[model samples]
Target: MDIINEILSSNILPYVLLGYAISILVVVIMIVLENRNPLKTISWVLVLLLLPGLGFILYIFFGQNFRKEKIIARKGLRNHHRLNNLAYSQISQLTHGSLGDNETARQPTGIVRLLLNNSSSLVTTGNEVTFLNNGKDKFEALLRELKNARHFIHLEYYIFAEDRIGNEVKKILKEKASRGVEVRLIVDDVGSWELKRSFFEEMRNAGVEVYSFLQVRFPLLTSKVNYRNHRKIVVIDGHIGFIGGYNIADRYKEGDAKTYGIWRDTHIMIQGDAVNSLQSIFLTDWYFVSRTELTDPKYFPASQPVSNKVMQIVPSGPDSDWPAIMMGIFHTITSARDYLYIATPYFLPSESVLFALKTAALSGVDVRIIIPEKSDAFITLLCSRSYIREMLEAGVQIYFYQKGFLHAKTVVADDKISIVGSANMDFRSFEQNFEATAFIYDKGAAQEMKATFFKDQSDSEIILLPEWIDRPYIEKVKESFARLFSPLL
Candidate 1:
């Protein structure tokens, strides 16, 4: 026993013990200071304990919680409190206004109230909403509106590739700028990493202002990588607005056989007071990137009532106290009476969302989710499978879209309410990235979206619980391992 002890207490044992001590210290610090999700905390602790060196590097790059710092700094620069108060006042007035008298408005009032109380999302009425499915229809309508831009055009996208579609849009912006119309564009630096400064030379020369959000510089690693602006927005003359999942890239459009096959997506075009809200979102992002506040009254022209559709623009990011879009989705799910339909490319959900979905399914509400069979991210695809068995056991029906990559982020409930926008049904979108979504409380719009969901379902293959359970042991192992790192993914 003495001989064994001497071997155990050798130099190697001391170094190993020291490494473990450091990892434990880091874990305690993270648990005490970060105050992140319990599952995420546990995951990080496991990573640190199991793989000390690589885990420390990963934590330094991705696991650090700098949301509080960013939120504080952002609020110091922008009048977020003032804007939030304005939105609250508008929501309060609308809640007590004549619109509340209608029975149509009564159904979604709880959701609207939840949004207002949590995120201060302003509810606007008399907006006309047109749902555009797939990129071809969306870009076609957008091009038509671009041609009709009388005053200004503002566009912001996560991915604005310098491809055929991107160059076409740039050409239109240059033409509009040459005609004395203001054209401003914002693209995410990380998402458009492949794009070069020379790609926008023509537009810049034509007087079109362009900027990249959170541009990364070499040798200075930062937390900006986690806080991306994932919103896709287009505002024309402050009267028409477009928001959804379609990015400014050729892959989103048809005929990109080499990249994505028949890219399926959804976007919404709005013509009413809601456009003002969309314009406000774009201008706020523009100010963040360019440091130029667009506060002119011309950008918020008086909007006439186009329809009786009630809409709210819900924007969420690391700047907020909590995940606004995720909470909105939760409220929408818990408020469902008849049916719920959801389609998203990513499927990883936070614990609260997963619980809500399981509870809803177990309560007899028809719950269905559609996801891509072959996702773009292999690890993400594997991680999504970990939750399938649980959800399936709870009576939730899962469909794997077989026709193409399903990139649409849409939710419709009870054929009366719908949410469509850039925020996917995943943790990255809900917690880390800046995202915008439109909550439409209109029976007609909801029915149309439900119909579209059914059409997509026709092309999807339902996953059976028995077959899923019978999947190979290796696949199950992969899924379990992938799920462990899903929080970071």
Candidate 2:
């Protein structure tokens, strides 16, 4: 006790406090030298000045921007070599008038070219797209396909919780593995932190190879924490695939009703050559996670042209040369002739997307966006509300979903294009996380997506400009405060 009192009374406490203050100052200076986006830099600086301890922790986990780093340099090029060839071949064929009699291909050429130039996303002309709305429909389709798996089953998701839905999936995977069908799974380490080691051990025991994406441990959490694989992809026998925003969790796809009503989401099941593109994405990520490059003729079975639906599985992340999905959305908005419709749970748009929406509306294009009235995140909802006034002033119409949470990320323009995927309409989905979007260039598909949007719109409340302008002063101030940290969110 006397020793502890002496230490507390000594000058060591002051020295420790001085050291912490200096550390915070050094981090702020380092952030400035990084030359990140001006808004993000200012946000970090203000956060540090206000709450030094908590801000530093949040920055370490979520704020580090590694856009200039090439972490996966070696195997990435070799893994994507075949897809790159396909992308170039498609570009050449389109350039030389090979698409002689197809008007569907001509309408989306601008966005197609943007994707090809930026990310080598191949435009697959033969695809059968099936849109699945809500959790029940998607899980039913997924389980049916899984039961028919013959050769291999590949699954990846941001969250693989050990819940009712997850256990159901694991049971199917184990049964498949026991029958000599190769089963592999990838789950994000941070997203699936609630999953215990024993759950994975059971899968491994049953011959299901499970690995976590970007293993997060002490001393390496800073670099790996910010970039998450938010993609949810499932490829069965290299012939059928699924991609969308639904994660493998009870809250995502368990039942009909919950604290938030039914989980309204959208996913697509694709059959034909387009599955090869989704397979390519899965193999690339698998190589990164497990380091086992599975490149064989069996992994990509020769697929025949099924339907005339043109589609491209576009992916974007920190490592991309450009934000392919974001740019494609912007181009669609700018090129919309009649109308632009969108549904997203989050509405924190980046500067370019915000500008495109506003400009399109001002130019006489009908722009409508629907967001959930009750969101899972309160702060995010507030930040989203902060942008509604400006959008309304620019003649953009906004709707609030009243039935339940609107967890679907979709966009349909001029009834000519349909986009559905895991990426949100926020900065993180476009700039920070690894995401995927399927661009279907078919009027039929677009009409179906548009119909779903209308059904949800019927269940929503349209917010008028005057009603929004007359919001409570305290609420507006709260949202304004949250808007200051939009980039971080």
How many clashes in each candidate?
A: 0, 0
Q: Which residue pairs overlap in candidate 1's backbone?
A: none
Residue lDDT tens for model 2, 1-489:
998688689989788778879988898999999987787888888888788689889887878878668444433456588777777887887787674247445757878878888888887767899899988889999999999999999999999988898899999999999999999999989889898999889999999999988888979888998888899999999999999989988877753365567778899999987898888888888887787888787998988877878888998887677788998888889999899999999999988899999999999999999999989889999999999999999999999998888899999998898999999999889888888899888999999999999999999999999989997899999999998899888
User: Worst 10-residue stretch by lDDT in candidate 1?
Assistant: 71-80
- Per-residue lDDT over 263-333 for candidate 1, one digit per residue giving the tens place of the 0 to 100 score: 99999999998898887678778778777776777988998888888888988887677688999999888
For lDDT, the strongest prediction is 2
Q: Supply the TM-score for candidate 1.
A: 0.92
lDDT of each: 0.85, 0.88
